[model samples]
Target: MKIVLASASLRRQELLKRIIQDFHIVVSNFSEDSIMYNNDPKDYVIKLSQGKAREVSERIDHEALIIGADTVVVLENKIMGKPKDEGDAFNMLKNLSGKWHKVYSGITLINTKDGKSISDYVCTKVKFSHISDEDIQKYINTGEPMDKAGAYGIQGLGGIFVEAINGCYYNVVGFPLNKISGMLKQMV
Candidate 1:
């Protein structure tokens, strides 16, 4: 079976590589603005994932199983997305310092041949160390957090700020391999 990943994320592609070998990657052009303005983070990600999957599925019917995923960080009911600027990154790091936050990754799998769809979410709790303003600036200067959600990428140099994590490591990295594997196995 042909599989397609509808995301431009290199992290997602790397994670998925551990499970599937024969697949294609297509970056989805769906606007992310809608997700930021939505009230429910869960629904926001699910919708984003579904939208990406549908976009890819439309081009490859009866031959593709499209997978799409969206992840975001939330603390105290406030959803935090990627930092818009360096100052924003610093502010985000300051806010996340010495606090616990929830990282949610919503995944969508769509089988075009059978018209079957699955949507689910995985959440991880991450606690941060007492990151100083200087450290935040140095981290931001590294330019690793610019494209990552919550202004930090656990799989990169930003890992130093994470004191502990209470869920799937891959989930924090942007994809939940076990969940996606289980869900896809039944379908494939």
Candidate 2:
């Protein structure tokens, strides 16, 4: 069966390549803004993932395994998605400075043939080093954090701010490889 990824994120695409060498990309039309966060970060992400997968499944005609994923950075129970603008990005970085935050990734798989589906989540604890306002501004100037959760990308220029991490490193990169592997094993 063909495998389809329901995301346009380069980081997610790169990570998925490590496991599945020949999957197809079908960016989902599902809008993240349509989903409301009910104070439950895990559930919120799972819903978003499922929404993406279901939306993409409708666009495919043949048998395929569709994968959808969403990631968020949570600090003190507050879920942080991509910033709307540079100012929002700066605020997110300032709030994350010198703090331990949890990065949660939600994965959803849909089998177009049998309609079997699975949704799961993985969380990683990431601690950011103390960031000065000047440094945060400089990082913001790089324009790397604008499209990332918590206004930072652990795999890019934002890596310098990360002092330590616990749990799957791939989770911080927006895809949890081991968790997705296990989920695929159960599905197949």
lDDT at residue 133 of model 1 (Cα atoms): 88
Q: Per-candidate TM vs. native?
A: 0.95, 0.97
Tell me how candidate 2 scores on lDDT: 0.94
Q: For model 2, how does the per-residue alpha-carbon lDDT over 121-149 read when each residue is reduced to its tens digit?
A: 99999999999999999999999998888
C-alpha lDDT of all candidate models, in order: 0.88, 0.94
TM-score between model 1 and native: 0.95
Clashing residue pairs found in predicted model 1: none
List where candidate 2 sits over 4 angstroms from the true fold.
Answer: none
The most accurate candidate by TM-score is 2
Report the C-alpha displacement of residue 173, candidate 2, in angstroms.
Answer: 0.6
